[model samples]
Target chain A: MAARAARFNQQVLIDTTPLPDSIPKVKEIGATSAPLLSAAFFIGARCKPYNDDYMMCKTEANGRGELECMKEGRRVTRCAASVIADVNTHCLSEFRKHWMCLENWNQQLWQCRRFERDLNKCVFENLKLEKVIPGAPADEIPVHLRKRQIYAHSYANM
Target chain B: MPQDMPPVGGYEPIQYKRNLPARGFRPAYYLLAVAGIMTYGFYKYGKGVRELNELGREKMWSRIHLIPALQAEEDRDQVRRMLADKARERELLGAETKVYHSDRFVRPTFAVVPENTTD
Candidate 1:
């Protein structure tokens, strides 16, 4: 009887969503990625321009310890920093808080949870919608929200 | 073999130095070595921070511009596909590669059947 009830519950869950035929056609195209090399360059160059520049100096310029490359790297870093600054002006604290916690307590998701929540909230509120995750499960509330004690009980068992 | 020195035995008499022997390298060298190690450590730390920042920055920028840029690209590709489809449709309907100079812009001409070919 218990197994039959469980099977019936699963069937009910499956039937909750509408059929594909009934769903409206979406005109909007899904998001895509920036070119890999360009994206990687932007990221690497932005953070550590000197090192990146030094490498470029060695490879692209075919020289050793080129000061020009370092200068170019600095320029790139400055440009990236300027752009980042513009973005950061809106939610720097939130970004910092979230990123710092993530960096420090990487393996401890529970410890990082509040900071993540705060950051997500801040980003959504302050920045463009494009900056936010479109269909994040983090925002979802459980249908039968588990109590603190229930979480504690589970942790205790572990 | 000084007369005051104890005789050598299985347990040889230890010589006590009045003063410690001078180090092979100067104090300055040791200081420099320690400083070098510290500088290397700092360099490593800075590199790690930079890498971490890069990762974080990339993730954040992706959230902001990457999606929108990709969507715009997709939309453009879609439009191009639509145009291609229309061109194909026109071709099927036997529209000659008609050069209708309607405006300043010259429309792209598609492949047309030769007028002499009956088959």
Candidate 2:
């Protein structure tokens, strides 16, 4: 009986885990980008330095050995932890902007761009990360494509 | 033989005693057992009903349907076309366009920074 009950609970959870189809916007971005978008939601001043350092390692270092950028990578992880903790405390209202944006904009990143920008802006400013340029695109747009464009342009010039 | 037959008529039949062990519990104990089983059954049924009702309520409350991570073929093609168009636009621009969008960035609602941070 206990085993049966466990199976029932698992099925219920599985049912709840997927995004609903009513929001076509989420369906449009589909599954591939959802995790990235979700991660993007939490980024702010707390994680900026690490994110910047990692980007520098990736782009300037040309994807070489991370032996040079290990410190930055570690800093990013540490910053992420503290930043996540801080968000759970001070910036809940700002954080809610993303939630509200998800519901209001139907999970469209482009539409929620303002809310994400607002969240990161609010959270990071509180962490004193405002003046520094973010390594990742602070906007809702995909940063990888932009990076690729730069790479492609540079190759063409060469 | 005639004497034995005569003795038989005078002989009485011997009476035999039967012994049986007493029951440890009273009849009321059986009644209590039945009642306890019924109560357990009813409690389980009530819990099942409550769980079912909660599941129904959740279904009613959910506004969005669950969309799987996989996209439809047409949707995937659409995304590909959009990417290609963006790439073409970038190529035409020659210089990299720093601005991804025209939306004005919103300010943060909270501004209390933690100390010991380098700029």
Candidate 3:
């Protein structure tokens, strides 16, 4: 017998409505997965304050934060969007190369170290936004800087 | 035939050496070498696991930090759509109807209306 669903709702609704005039507007981020992963740390580095403020506002608003934290939310969105735009403008080639490598390599940073190094250098120099993993061990070299990635598919770096 | 047997010094005392080259350390030394290698390998493995753990932690924290900004973008989009749906509802039907029992951003079931059949 064929299965029929009655109680469970599996419907998805997509409403292409614009925000009302009462609310301010912000443009959503345009970059997809690979680029977003590659640029995440830099975005975190650049937007720490705004991000923290937004989170704090959300926490204070509790369940009501969705609508209440619009101001803080707008700041967070703008901060992230600005970081992405800046990177795209300043380090276009390096950014493209790194994200492309990431996309081809299952988004594994270890497999894309060479491109990542180049991208990091360019972003740091042009945007002054460093990619740092906060709370990483201070005594040892960061994973990104290691000469060999034990888990990489290719032995080229090793 | 002049008794060709027992020539000088009984046929040169019949040499018995096989000429095989001797090599390799004592068994105890070999054991020690294996132990040393294993110890170093285990140490390296532990170091690698720790590094991997730290990397994962760093990655998770990075994502957590980025969530606020990403969520803000998504929330804004949702808010825009909800507002748009509200406007559409008002245009199609002359008045807004209360559809929820409690207030917590319920995506209205009638938000996306299929083609109207009523003329």
Q: Pick the candidate with the highest DockQ.
A: 3
Tell me the spans in candidate 3 whose CA falls farther than 4 Å from its real position. A1-12, B1-27, B88-119
Candidate 1: give the clashing pairs: none
The residue-by-residue lDDT of candidate 1 on A1-158, one tens digit each, is 66675443332321122213322233322211212211222233333444444446646754432323434433443444443453367667755665565455442223344544555466456543222322233544321121221212124211
The order by descending DockQ is: 3, 1, 2
**TM-score of each model, in listed order:** 0.25, 0.27, 0.78
Which CAPRI quality tier does the interface of model 3 achieve?
acceptable
lDDT of 2 by residue, A27-116 (tens): 132222333233342443335455655656646766542334444544554454454456657667766666565555444433454455
Q: Give the TM-score of candidate 1.
A: 0.25
How far out, in Å, is residue B103 in model 2? Answer: 50
DockQ (model 1, Cα): 0.01
Query: CA lDDT of A115 in candidate 2?
Result: 52
Per-prediction DockQ: 0.01, 0.00, 0.30
* Model with the higher TM-score, candidate 1 or 2: 2
RMSD of each: 26.8, 26.0, 6.6
Model 1 Cα lDDT, one tens digit per residue, B18-115: 77788689989999999999999999888556444444543554444332223233333443433444455576876734356564333345423222
Task: Give the distance in Å from residue B95's predicted Cα in candidate 1 to where it truly belongs.
Answer: 55
